[model samples]
Target: MAEWWRGSVTYQVYPRSFQDSNGDGIGDLVGITARLPHLAALGVDAVWLSPIFKSPMADMGYDVSDYTDVDPLFGDLAAFDAMVAQAHALGLKVIIDQVISHSSDQHAFFRESRQSRDNPRADWYVWADANPDGSPPTNWLSVFGGSAWEWDARRRQYYLHNFLPSQPDFNFHNPAVQDWALEVLRFWLERGVDGFRLDTVNYYFHDDQLRSNGPMPTRDNRPPVNPYDLQDHVFSKSRPENTGWLERMRALTDEYPDRTMVGEVGDAAWRNVAIMAEYTQPGRLHMAYSFDMLGPEFTAGHFREKIEGFFAGAPDGWPMWAFSNHDVIRHASRWASHGAPDAVAKLASAMLLSFEGSVCLYQGEEAGQVETEVLFEELTDPPGIRFWPDYKGRDGCRTPMVWDASEHGGFSEVKPWLPVKAPQLARNVAAQDGVPGSVLEFYREMLAFRRMTPALQVGRTRFFDLPEPVLGFARGDGLACVFNLSARPVVLTATGALIDGAPCHAAHLDAGRLLLGANGFAFLRPDGGLGLSAG
Candidate 1:
């Protein structure tokens, strides 16, 4: 029988920052292969590797120039094949990042598309003529900044770029483009990859009318760091055409046994979850993740709302939860007000693992790594460079992973692509490896606990209605589990005896009086009676 992905844990590795094998200051396929044992020991069932495809590094591999080959910077195709074999040998499934929504301007299809109006691949990209006034035809804006449309002097037209201009959006409306993209996906499937993590999954198409988007409502106005956020984005992305293509993608994946696809839906609205539900029901993506929990929201109510709302929107569609990733501030820094970094990190790991769907653990998160402050001059992410002080961009979170306290934090023999700050060095893997109760140890124990407990691994969740700042939920295959995210002692009432608790945490079930300490959680079985109290 095929196993469900829900309730599984996936470790995400940003290839560029994971490790440097050849001491080139950049991580590569061999480096990732060398680290497979570490990931396997971390207890993750799967590893989601960021893009390592051939690219010009326009958007750091998000702009793919070739779909079937690895970039020389990362390694050759043989290296990728070796990594895949090694990962599978360690019982770890491999999911590679797939950026089908757009391709580098240097891609053969895009290059040919731009060369002649009558070429076979001419309509492979989203190209439109400029307005009579010599301006872009629409009001769409690029996520990196400025207009999403870039004028192409050669074609006497403007090309659409949902992200950086170098990443030109493909014309999903064109049948040939869809076939080409599907072929690229097939190439990976044939290479024995387990699945894909679709980047910007919703940006595959645009409104064909080229109509300007209307002004975003006042409440929606955040900052203007990315001009794309200044508009409603109705005509720019998340088009209805995307649904059909998603179905097609799903059908393609279904052809392979046990294969999966998890999409990264980059919208801020709660409705994004609903769209994910629509896309993944029966035959679309196997799962989808949003940016809801990645923000500064840390209260129990915030997490409760996000999870409950997601489940409500897509009861059947699995969700992939992550508190930190390559694109945002580390959770320790984002939720620093909660308490000590280690405590918050442990609490987050516990909470995320207890959720009803799949979970993603970003690299370095096991070390309780906080966001490193990168100055403007050292910034490598274009978004951060564009939105300087207000939004420091992602470079802060993209710092190289620290393996030891050695120079360069043992990430590279030479200086790394991104500097490993002193504070991060202190939290390197070697420093925390054997320490009792260290964040890394805590993660290992938690993951091991989840693996042992059927409820945590494959049970259904029933969220309990508890007081504010105290989020409570029950997960069991006939047993009950409860959690309190607050820092204050609270009374927890359950039906049965307390069966287990996390490391360094305790619970008691004497005469129906349950006492849960600050930031504590408990696992229990029903006592068959009601009216329990912690006091």
Candidate 2:
């Protein structure tokens, strides 16, 4: 039987900003449970909740203090159970963020591991002695700012952390650690989660030799805000040993029926595609996503290359594409320079859904939410505060979901964790619920369209040699997909019969000439293979 996740849409819910049922200025499982209907209406198959596990709130919930328990900030075990039950009732599968690569420094394993050299759990985390000059162990830089190694007085050694110092990387070389991590997965599986989103899946294992990484080759491209991007990072992450662990996880997931796992391969574009291919083989992750499509490039060539490149590298591997998540700027605001915000938003939704693989839609993205402009004092992301004006951090995209035009956008009756600004509030769910031509309505229509179209749902993609501002591809046997990847209008001579799923904007095929307005897209069932000649 085919898995339900193949070519399905999964919605990502950032718990803190989604909704607040208790008016505590924070969103809990109770709040998420109350909003299950929203996902059901959006026609998503699953809900991927960003880390709601026990944490001290450092680095948001990515720093897991207790893997087996829910954070008090979100809710308790009962709340999680109830939420899972409600999601199941609404026909939505629950997929949680499994931060297995690292854990909060406050975790019991880390605490015990850091206590003494010969303690029972001393080998649980990556710890190494300093060099002769009492300096750090390696030249590794943290993703946040400074050194990746933090000196621990208790163990008299420096420990490894890829992100915040408080979130230490585990020692995957230790077999005991692997056993414990698998146990954590089983714990959640028993609680009725349908799947897992493996966070930092590539960072699970490090080069056991602790070798230094080489410098990244210089290019004309824009560099990341942090110095961490300067290194090739071969020694720190994406080790070959990680595949063994993924196989172990797959074995555990296979214990239950209808389970799935999607890995997050964190690396540069060149290596990310290969890693995603490797991690998503039959015995490993069911699917994986890379940061390739998450960057600033918005063009027909860029999208075409990424989609083609992945299939070229791994024909059998599955890929999951997403434009916006908790990590980066929202697509509507990020690509606003190319087209109108609302138009770009709708176009992105249409293009993403039409892609060959599965898809993920971040919460509030259906309403064309743009990244908020956050100020210095109001900043909460570690990297944003560390880098100030240069990098404002992810807080812009992590603002509360606006349900209404009321105070705080009805996300909460009281003040929310993040401020509810005017721009975000103006695009509230209530305002666009039934409004035709609204981004929200467009998303609902497109999702339903994808569900109904067999070709769009599970079709193989074959690209056409269309020039700039125009991308043409054939999906399934007959459906020819074409798009104008610019704010300017374009027209081409092609042979096809127009097919309507979602509304086509300013597009029509008449007398063998296909006219596409600015930001226009169309689907056609041609009499034969699409033959094109642009005027």
List CA RMSD, all candidates: 2.0, 1.3
- 1-535 per-residue lDDT for model 2 (tens digits): 3588888899999999998988799998999999999999989999999999999999999999999899988989999999999999999999999998999999998999998999988999999999999988888889899989999998889999999999999999999999999999999999999999999999999888888899898675887678898899999999999999999999999999999999988897778888888888789999997688898998889999999988888888889999999999998898998788888888899899999899999999999999999989899999999998888999999999999999899889999999999999899999999999999999999999899988887899999888888888998898888888898888888786788554576688898888888889888887665444555
**Predicted structure 1, TM vs. truth:** 0.95
Please give each candidate's TM-score.
0.95, 0.98
Candidate of highest lDDT: 2
TM-score quality measure for candidate 2: 0.98
| Residue ranges of candidate 2 with Cα displaced over 4 Å | 220-224, 529-535
Q: What lDDT does model 1 reach?
A: 0.83
lDDT per residue for candidate 1 within 1-535, as digits (tens), equals 2754667789999999998999899999899999889999888899999999999997789999988999998999999999999999999999999998999989988889988789988888999998899989988878888888898888998999988889998899998888878898999999999999999999998999888898666555365655565577777878888888999998998898889889998774755777777776777888887677888887768877777777787777888889999998999898888766777788888888887788999999999999998989998888888888888989999999999999999889999888899999989999888898899998999898888887887777776666666666777655555555666677755567766554435445576666767666665666553233545
